[model samples]
Target: MLKGKPKYKAIRILEGCGFHAQMGLEVLEQRSLINTSPNGYLDMHDHIEEMGRNIACRLHPNEPNKRRRLCDKEEIEEVLVNDLGTKATRIMNLKNPSIHPATIIEKLRKMKALELLSVYDADRVSQNWVFDEDVQYFPDTLRSLHWTGYPASSLPKTFQANDLVNLEMTRSCISQLWEDGDRKVE
Candidate 1:
């Protein structure tokens, strides 16, 4: 009922509402798909139903009961097979709080959706995982990253390696090096 340029405020409120509604739609769509009759007995309807329940729980308005459910192997397989398609393989690479790489890869390969490559690291879960010199399939975006736990092998390969040459080889090395440089100037 307020007046004078409430367009921005109205837009914000409407956008927020739309976002939640969109999420609910996705949940409903997934639910409908899960309820659809499977092609065969091995169609994993039980697993799909569980995943749909989890999704519904997450999108529920009850904040106290909205705790995100960690997906298991069966749930991951069902979602990958029935929901995400090729994007499922990419998402499989993500570090799930509760799921296994073998489980994901097994289903993906069985579905002929992804090729299991021995070249890739299976246990690579953390965002801080190290890369070796032989790593060939790394993303180009990773090259310019400034993460705290930079790989020791890659350190010498970066522009910042020159800083190591300035380091002194002793206890209180940094302070001692500064003092030494000051004395040399005087």
Candidate 2:
């Protein structure tokens, strides 16, 4: 058993390790751990199941067999809006190996308190996926959006480039940024 005072506000569960989800939850609930490192063993799967709604996960890369564990839109909404309540912020789906593009879009659309969102897929090619809703649903608090393989032909009518500090959308199908004649080039 590990001993010593818990000084870290965040923890990382190394891949293939046998860290029990309940134990991690106990430490988080009792010790006030507020964050979890990205691309590690402790992912959204653990978060949703272990009562980690208030704790912000920096990234949520898909598991090797992600299709079986993928949370539907309702579950994602429940975790972010109902469970996390006002504490939900950053949501990262970067490097997800098998998640459908629409699923990622739906997740983003439902999350309102997001400050950083990463839906980058390093392995996939552009699929020209269209979001059912407009991007305007994205919170004004959002500052970073890193979505690789974005398939839309243009950003939603509500997107304002001024609000974003870091924007990376490689392999996107955007032919134009906005419909209005005013285009801001930096």
Candidate 3:
């Protein structure tokens, strides 16, 4: 599970994967593990938050490629630069990435087991970060994705959505998901 409180979409995916987030929330509420913040976000005690981070870090202390999630910019950049991602990485949520979008997509080919990937503006306002080139590939195991300000006119011809359950591209420059090919519809 992720360190911070999961959002609505994440809860839905957790439910799809057989997790009862509502039930867990109830338990947390009963135990005072969380408090409703002024802005409505769940706030966890600092110690609890630290414990969660520690648990995630202890999973594979020496190897980031074995971690299930990569949320840090530097670690993600290092992994991308070194091509160290493995099948163990299931979720990658990047916000305002400084690295080239091309490099990110190019290295994603190695994450064969990636299921949830999001590269969006954290503030939900910036429109500066845009993918200039066509994404040539996406893992066949993807279940959810979010890419804001996608500048390409269409997704890659090689890309397929056979296993995609959720796809959100808000304020993107995309004109179509894919081009009309030399084929017929059923």
lDDT of 3 by residue, 84-151 (tens): 98999988878877776667877888999898888865443334444544555677677777787554
What Cα-based lDDT does every candidate model obtain? 0.28, 0.46, 0.70
User: Against the hidden true structure, what lDDT does model 1 obtain?
Assistant: 0.28
Candidate 3 wrongly placed segments (more than 4 Å): 1-8, 34-50, 121-135, 181-186
Model 1 C-alpha lDDT per residue in residues 10-69, reported as the tens digit of each score: 233323323353344346447654221232111224666566656745653243112233
**Backbone clashes, each candidate:** 0, 0, 0
Q: lDDT tens string, model 2, 47-137?
A: 4444443222213332211121222344344443333323243344445436566555544554455555555565665676666655334
**Best candidate according to TM-score:** 3
Arrange candidates by TM-score, highest first: which order?
3, 2, 1
Candidate 1: 10-residue stretch with minimal lDDT: 165-174
Of models 1 and 2, which has the larger TM-score? 2
